[model samples]
Structure formats: C-alpha cells, structure tokens
Target: MSSIDPMWRLTCVYGELRTENRQRMWNTIVDLKNRSNLPWLVVGHFNEVLWQHEHMSETKRPEPQIRVFRDTLESCGLVDLGFTGVPFTFNNNQSGRKNVRVRLDKAVAIDSWRDLFAETEIKHLTTPCSDHSPIGLTLIKETSQPTVRKVRHYEIVWEKAPELEEIIANTWASLEHNGDLASKFYQQKLEDMSRDYFKDLFAADPNITPDEIVDLFETKVTNMMNEQLCAEFSDNEIADTLF
Candidate 1:
C-alpha cells in the first residue's frame, strides 16, 4: 500500500484465488493496513464474492470462498461500493449451454476516503471479442462557469412612397453638405421607422412583403392627389383628374 498523494492512496490485488488461497489474500490485506497510513482506497478483482446472491446464476451448494472474502473485508475495515448496474462481471454468451457468471471486480474504500470520491461512477461496456464486458470508471471534476460574448442589436426601416430617383437625389444632396451627419441621421431614422412599421405589420401578418407595402403607400398617395384635384372648380381640371 503506497500513498499517491496526501488525500489519495491505492492498493490492488489480482489473479484467480481458490479456497486454499483465501488465507494468503487475508494476510495481504492485514499487512497492508499495518504498513500504510490513513485515507486509502483498495481496489481490483478480488475473484471471490461475499454472498452467493452476488452471482447472477444460481449455485445449489454454497461456497466457503464467499465467507472468507466477507470476513476479510470486515477485518480490513473497508466499505463495499455496490456494483452500478448488472451484478455479473463475466459472461460466456451461452445462455443455457455453458452459462457461468460471477461478480469478481470490485472497489473498496475506507470511510474517510469516501468524501474524496463523491462523484465516482462505474459503467459496463459490451465487448464482442472478450469474455468480460469492459468496465469503465469515471471521476467528475468541478469546472468554472464559461464566459459569454454580448451581441449588438440592429433595426431596419423602409421608406414610404419613395421613388428611386427621389432616394438618389436625397442621398446626393446629403453628400453635398459639409458633414455626413445629415445623411447618417436620415438613414438611421428611416431604418428605425421601417423596423417599427415592419414589426407591427409582422405582428398582424408575418408574411407581409416590402414590395406590397410600397405599392400600398403609392396607391394611398395617388388616391389623395386625385381627391384634391377633384375638389378644384375648373371643368377641364375635373376632366383631367378623372382621366
């Protein structure tokens, strides 16, 4: 048993062990405790199950190997972190032919060591080539919050009953002025107005088009001019207005 850090220490034992070898395994655990300091984790395949129920398949005769494993665990003052999902660690893939499964792999830690591994997880993965499904262990680490960037907002406005020639004329007139302030002010105001109008129109009918709005504005102006011309007294003017 060696201390990896001030808080963490690990000891492992591997390989197959029969009933006769149980005493040697227990002796190893006892020696490690007498040799190592506090706050340690003991993990690996212990080839022995504490209970007959730990095996997925039914065993008609209870094995003395299980009793020895349980007693050794109690003697070492270790706590068993239960299997995450399926209890069996090895499978033969033969359902009824030669199905022999067992829980051999395990992780055991002291009481103080539990707090260091607060978010530990164990998962089993399917393996086509091997007899045992791969077991994966995960340790979650705390992370700081991510920084985010701010986004700028923009508004777009459309000109009402604006002829192409008039737009060009106004743009040139603004350019001819001493500063570009007038052009910028007009452009910004138009964009804001267009955005407001489009927002209202979109609320009413989201599919409204720019061309349709322009046509509507032109039609309204033409109708107003026609009405004013009609109100004039000259008969020739009324005729011209009607035409």
Candidate 2:
C-alpha cells in the first residue's frame, strides 16, 4: 500500500515474447480494470508497441498485434502516461544495424485518476544491466485512515438441551489440547454428531435454503428450552446452550 491513494492498486506485468502470450497479458490488464472503478495504474514490460515509429532500425512493426494492445487499453479505459527519460525503454544491446529498440515499457492509468490524484507523475529510470528501464510513479494525494472490517464467530450447538451443557463442558475439559485425542478432534466429532442429529432436515426438503436451515435450528433450540423448563430446571439452566 502507498501513502497516497490507499484504495487504488498498482499492477506490474512482465510480458512474454510470443504473440498469444502477449494477448493474454493485455486480457489480464482488462480483467484487473473490471475489478474496480478506483484509481488504478498498470505499467510494465508489455513487449508490444502501438506505433511503427516506436521501433527503430527494425523490420516494420506488426499492425494487427499492436491493434490488439490498443484495443485492450481502449476497452479497459486506460491511457498511456508517456515517459520522460528515454525514447526506447528496452534494448537488445546489440551493436550497429542488428540493434533492436522499441518503446514497449509503459505506464497507463484510468481516467478517474486525474480527478482524484491531480499531481501524479511518471518517470523512467536507467537500468544498469537489464534490457528494460525501471519506472518511478508519484501519486500526490491527501492521505486518509484505512477502513477496518469486523468478523463474527459462532459457537458449537450448546443451546439444544440444558443437561447437554454440563455434559459437553465436562467432556471438553477432559480432552487434551494436542495429540490424537485432542479438543479439536472432539469438536469435529461434535460437529458430525450435530449434522447427524439434523440429517432429517436436509432429507425432508430437496431444496432447503440456508435461512430455512438456520430457522429450523432455532426452532429445535427453542423446543429444547421448553422441554428443560417442563422438567423443573432453573431459568439459568434452561438458558444453558446456544446455537
């Protein structure tokens, strides 16, 4: 995560030489674009250039392949930010006419980024021993606190019967925390027992909704509570187990 635009994501890709692999790379970018409308930046060694002029002293660049790359960016609503340091980001490092260079490395972003982060800048950096140039992205925006989400947990079905509460507690306390006969193993045993107890609920209806199952569990718990009350159990004892 960055200090600026914490909600946005920056994705980098190392593209392949083969045509099909390169097409897959652009398709991946479009997939990422569909995931969010937030400020996003996709940049890296794309290996394909949009224009013939991007290739220097090489054979005429393939048009159909470049068209796919352009179409992918258009569909994803991404625009090239254009570089600063050099014309060509990659070099074969070969000498004379054999030398091949193309502006394949790039930085692109969604249009909404201009509205949110108005002072963002892209800079190309020199690479010492690599074919591709490194890039620096500066997104200047006001920082806000990150949002936190709360997660909830449910306990085992203790609410079914008042007598079952003390029975389960004593049985659980007697088990070891680790080893073959551990609490975890016994907990799984209890879960299987509960499922077996509720097996008729599933068998009764071929298309029972999750809500219906929960409702059935609640009804069963309530009935158990009433049974405990009739057996002259204390109010506290009747409220023992919860599902």
The CA lDDT of each predicted structure is 0.67, 0.73
lDDT by residue (187-230, candidate 1, tens digit) is 66556555566666736555655664454343444877888877
- Positional deviation of 87 in candidate 1, in angstroms? 2.0
Candidate 2 lDDT, 1-52, residue by residue in tens: 5677347777887888888778778777888888887887787888888778
TM-score of each: 0.52, 0.53
- Alpha-carbon error at 44 in model 2, in Å? 1.3
Best by TM-score: 2
Runs off by more than 4 Å, candidate 1: 1-5, 60-63, 141-243
Scored against the true structure, residue 94 in model 1 reaches a CA lDDT of 64
The deviation in Å at residue 80 for candidate 2 is 0.4
Sequence-dependent TM-score of model 2:
0.53
* Worst-scoring 10-residue span by lDDT in model 2: 150-159
Q: Name the best candidate (by lDDT).
A: 2
Record all residue pairs in model 2 with backbone atoms less than 3 Å apart, i.e. clashing: 158-241, 159-241, 159-242
Task: Give the Å error, residue 104, model 2.
Answer: 1.5
